[model samples]
Target chain A: MQIPAPFEYVRASSVDNALALLDRHGPESRVVAGGHSLLPMMKLRLARPDWLIDINDLFELDYLLVDTVPNNGRVLRIGAMTRHTTLLESDDIKRLFPIVIDAERVIADPIVRNRGTIGGSLCQADPAEDLSTVCHVLEGVAVVRGPAGERMLSMAEFHRGPYETAVAQNELLIEVRVPIRDDSGSAYEKVERRIGDWAVAAAGASVTLAADGTISHVAVGLTAVGLDRNVTEVEAVLVGQAPTEQLFVEAGRLTSLACDPLADQRGPVDYKRHLADELTRRVLRAACRRAAASISDITI
Target chain B: MQISMTINGTFVTHEVEPRVLLVHFIRDDLRLTGTHWGCDTTNCGTCVVLMDGQPVKSCTVLAAMVDGHTITTVEGLANGATLDPVQQGFMEEHGLQCGFCTPGMMLTARALLDHNPHPEPLQIREAISGQICRCTGYATIVRSIQWAAEHPAGAAPETTTSESTEQEVHA
Candidate 1:
């Protein structure tokens, strides 16, 4: 097997050392986490780095912290290096973000999940990834560390375009923070061509039911349908109206309207837009059902 | 970069290019013909090897990244003349026809059995998900793993249990 490009290998024991290596190598070095995304790209000759700073050994970047919190407080802190399998098997993820867990369960099977890191997935910004769309719906923030310091960027602002991210060449994503919901309902659904292949379309919905059985807050993020995955403003339609199939159909239409899927070899633009509407409808219905189940009070 | 790693129970250090994948080092330089390469991508587990006793795709790994690590390839599975239990099980159960997927299947099975000695059918299926076998169907491959699970001592120290996992790496 011929590796695509020549690179200087440097295994850093800690985050600081990795940063130092990146600083020293600058644009020539590629920081490999799980290499689930990078290695494949390298093999295809898309990216050719002369230096690789292997940072997967940085154990500190693999912690999953979960706790009860007040409004605007930290609910969950997931280290970037945590694998998809960990997310699938995590109790905290199951209790807080069942959609994330559910989505992860179907992520490229068990072996890919075992090696695919959350940081790499997020950083890759694959439009079809369920977790990326899930993060967008949950208003997730990526905490990145670089030579200068660390900074947090929201998912919406972090992703610049297709297969692009705001992460600096020298920066390393250290953590991704997702707000935990005690009673809110969130769900993710993906349509795929194969068991281990990337998704054709994925949609995530997070809805908070009010005491009056109406929607308090609603966010919908749709992926694998646009130039870049995006979260549409579905709150206006969801706030007071009943989450009926008819309303979701309208929401799906509007969501599809918000998308700009370019025609690719896999599908035509019209077909992808149709998928956006259908997937949006399915995921919204699923989310509505889950949210309806979480309605504690019958005040309204 | 010059890399040093123990492959097949023997220690050998060699200077290699930085772009040389661990699979290339094992197959070309080290001359271990047993570790086959099907895809040269992580998707195919044909290049799978035990890096510090953990299953990893050698095709995606840089040889220098595994410096000083003890790697167990398919060639390392047998104890000299005696075949490993997993290998013998594959033969006895007729797990393979062309035998191209045998090495990858064995490594995948060995990794799974190491963690969960008694794996369910679903677990066995999941263990070999990384490997892509186009020959003889997966039924026999899965049965061979189950056979090994039943008869643990079909082959010597079995080669699977003698892994030198003194320390753990996150990768």
Candidate 2:
């Protein structure tokens, strides 16, 4: 019979209303979307906020838009209230970034996905959160709205640590922006103890191939291995290199050496590092293959 | 706080604490005991109920959050004395052993079939992956969903007795 402590609940009718409520409630209030992560923590007495402002009715924040105005380049804008199930079923998202689909499939389960929002997942900032890793690898930018105004921050700046984010007490994360690249593909690989358990170790990779078969851009992000962002050292090694098995192996070695994993029931440090290396290699290989296929599709 | 929503096709309003979970609201307040509560954590699927025709874990949802939404519990699956196709499918395919997970499983099956009329076996498995059925090993549960998909209009009257016999054999 788990239950949360007594609190005040208020529903915000619109985005401005939500922001106003947040401003009025001050630091003691927390905005809840989906409530999958927050409610569980509440039940455990881990997160006992004085006020919970429900933003589920802000339908204006539930959108998926692809903008190609050329001035801002091509970018995918996902509203903060977008649910995990919506992301899983979006064909546009599947065609643009399959890594999201891969991670969403293994996030929680169909039932949790129904109400879990992408904004809530990012805001929760669990060190092992899969969407954070996927967004990090893809270089996602978060658009946050506060009482003063709106500001955009990269994934690195947005995520301060586990359960912490740049979203202030009076601010709301409004949207996530991912830059779409031509001739590029992304993939995510995870190893978990069970079907819907948190990842023992997960890796996400996005690669862009040049016309001459060289890697123009590459990034690898890991989850549950104590790393906050993508593996910049591995990305540096593969950026200008050719798409070859040898390069992937070298990248894998660098990943294994660079990550700082902890020992727990999931695995010992060594095993987690091994998974980081192997999953990194797997995602990189898949990303390169998909990148090549994208190039071919463009040429055809 | 005061909240009103449509539950089992009936409009209901209740005053509940802000921290009350939707599952508690349904079972304890509304007295819809068919929706079982298990694993206070969100990991278990026994607390699943349809929110606006989509399966959501009610244990994690605040009652106030579903203010204007429509909820479908296992009790709503049947029409008067007639059983839903999913309920019939369960009885025909012997989907339950202890019956603790049946209500949630049937509601999920109904939601899946509503969205996808004919899902593959793999799809059915994936759809119910969040739920844990400690008794039936999930094979019969998958078969039960398949049975529902085949008999969308419910089982014929003549087949009821034979299906009961088959269910008895499995039990």
Candidate 3:
């Protein structure tokens, strides 16, 4: 029978109300979206906040839209409160970013997905979190709002460390923006012990091929292997190169060498490194194939 | 804090600590013990209840968060002197051996059937993947859900022991 320590609960009526409450409560306050991740941590005494501001009623923040910026580019904007079930069911997400659908299918069971939110997953910042890797590969931007107004931060800046994020105590993550690219496709591959278990090692790849079958841009990110972000060195190896088996093999080798995996019950450090390499190759192949298909779809 | 919500179609309110989980609030406060408490962590789906017609693990939800929401527990599954089709299906298919995991399983099946009138066996299995039945009677459970799907208009509330035994022998 686990129970969280006593706390005062307040329901925020709107985004403004939530930020004001956070400002009033100061650093001891925590905002709960789905409560799937936060409540469990509270029960274990790992996170003991004196005040819990429930933002479940902030329906204004629950949206999924694709907007075209004046010159920056077209971007997919997902509200922070959007649940996993919504993401898994969205045809737009499936067609535009199959990597999200692939990872959401195995993130947790359907029951958990019904309540878990995209923002909650990001803020938790668990080393094994799949969305982090997906966002890293896609170059996600987090829009945070506070008393001082809004500021956008890249995924690299948003993630501080394990269980830490750039969201200040007086701030709330309002939305996440991912730039949509043409002639690009993304895929995520993971190796877990069981059906709903966390990944032992997961890899995500996004590839954009030029008109002549050369790689214009490519990025690879890994999960549960202690890699903070995508492997820029591997991306450099693929950029401007032809999509060949030899290039993929070299990229895999470089990925395995660059990642820092720790040994635990899941597998040995060396085994995880090997998985990082293998999964990277697998996702890159899938992504490149999808990229080619997208190109053909456009021409047709 | 004082929280009020509709449970089993009845409006109920109680003063509960913010730390109290919806599972305990249902079982202890409301005395609706049908919603079992298992693996206090969200791993087990034994404490699942329908929140606004969607299945959610009650153990992970705080009582205060469910304020003004509609909650349907196992007690609300059937009308007076009648059983829900899922209940009848369970009895006919012998879906339970221990009965501890039955309430949550039935609620999950009910929600699934509400959305998808006729779900395939694979869909049914995927819907209940979060729940852990220590009895390991998933085969019968899946069959029971399938039976309910086949008889959407509702079936006889009860089946005699001899009839079930005969069906079991044939099975």
Highest TM-score model number: 2
Summarize candidate 3's per-residue lDDT along A188-252 as a digit string, tens digits: 99999977789999999999989988899998999999998889989888999878888889999
Per residue, candidate 1 scores C-alpha lDDT tens digits across B64-110 of 77888899999877766756668878987999988887887898788
TM-score for each model: 0.88, 0.96, 0.95
- Assess the local accuracy of residue B16 in candidate 1 as a C-alpha lDDT between 0 and 100: 90
- Tens-place lDDT per residue, model 2, B34-98, is 99999989887998999999998889999989998999999998877768878989999999999
lDDT of 2 by residue, A1-300 (tens): 899999999999998999999989888898999998889889999989999999999999999999864444789999999999999999888988999999999998888888889999999999989999999999989999988999889999999988889999999999999999988989998999999999999999999989987899999999999999889998778988888888889999999988899999999999999999999999999999988888764321
Candidate 1: tens digits of C-alpha lDDT, residues A173-292: 998888866457888877777667677777778877766666777888877777354444566887887667788888889888888777776678888788888888887777767777
Off by over 4 Å in 3: A297-300, B156-171
- Report lDDT (Cα) of residue A1, candidate 3: 81
Give the true-contact fraction for every prediction, in order. 0.57, 0.94, 0.89
- Candidate 2, residue A271: the lDDT equals 96
* Counted clashes in each candidate structure: 0, 0, 0
Cα error, candidate 1, residue B168 (Å): 22
Docking class of 2: medium
